[model samples]
Target: MPSTDDLGSVVDAAVRARLDDSGQACDAAERFIVADDLYDGFVEKFTAALLDRRSGAPLSSVAAAGTLARQVAAAVAAGATLHTEGERRGAHFPAGVLTGLTTEHATARQELSGPAAMVFRAAGEADALRIANDTPYALGWYVFTTDSARAGRVAGGIEAGMAFVNGVGAEDAELPFGGVKRSGSGREPGRPGIEEFVGKKLVRTVA
Candidate 1:
């Protein structure tokens, strides 16, 4: 078993390494001092019991999965760019495996399940629509509406590149997948998804 002091040192080293890799440089004194403080704070909040080896009250894996999925989906809707780094962890699985599996451009309507759906429902249509539109990774977004007619109107009002009526993950090859803002620089799937990887050259024609 690693001593508390040893664990603290390890976390400190990890933080320093991350900062260094990100092109950050600080005096060793500052790094050590700050790292110690952060390590202490972390330990205070998260003790050895929280460690993977320790057993405690169990968490619902289903709920955990739902929460994670929703968070990822929300990030996508917010126009955030999703990229992969390091050893291609499971976090990259969704975007990597799903990107080209379907049409060139497709909208994924992911229905919230279990507690996740309740969370989404609580957000109300306006908030839900806003989250859906603002997320960067969204090709299209959907939520089940109490009123299909109302949902149709609301979908039309949404600013997302695409919107679905009480539907989730309804993507079409002919359609486009992209988001506004920080979602990414361009679209994917269809001509847009293709354009992300290719550049255009304009030719001048003289008659």
Candidate 2:
């Protein structure tokens, strides 16, 4: 059987094909960097303050997404590998075979608000957990595994407010959504969803 990441790529490809069929090539993908050898391929692009990835906009006047601006700058400073998918066209960014991420890098610690991803290398479950928790923010997390027992164990250790386990898009109206640390301060659904927005008052008088 293919690895989960491989399966994920296949799914991504399928989604891209569907998007192409719908004539939305410039719509589905946002420009971002992918580095295989952080030091060799990604640093120079940053020194000149040039865009390391490709975006759909036709003009160079286009700027990086504000949400990702800081994170991208951090990645560049940490010297992580960065590049676009092809010859750097259309706010072009690296699009395939993403690799070369380290927990020590700022990219690993920061919350990426735009179309960016970091692929860190971890030794095992414990190490992965440590890396995951090393960050200050824990809005959400994901666990993809066939073993239910392992899933439960990992889920419990993760500090995030929401977790999607085993399956993707596994959300419902009844489940409360919120986060800890800097992710969120309150819940948005379930009973707490309405409760957070409400104010209750009571009065008593002798008759």
Q: lDDT scores for all predictions?
A: 0.35, 0.49
| 1-207 per-residue lDDT for model 1 (tens digits) | 001334454443323322231211211101011122333454332222122222122223445444545544564555433332222222221211011111111223332211111111113445445444433343344433445666676667666565554333356786676655443446667987887788789999998
lDDT (10s digit) by residue, model 2, range 21-82: 12122212222122223322233332122223323433222253433445665676777755
Which regions of candidate 2 fall more than 4 Å away from where they truly are?
Answer: 1-70, 86-98, 201-207
Which stretches of candidate 1 lie above 4 Å from their native place?
1-139, 145-149, 204-207
lDDT of 2: 0.49
How big is the positional error of residue 2 in model 1, measured in Å on the Cα after superposition? 54
- State every prediction's TM-score relative to the real structure: 0.34, 0.63
Per TM-score, the best of the predicted structures is: 2
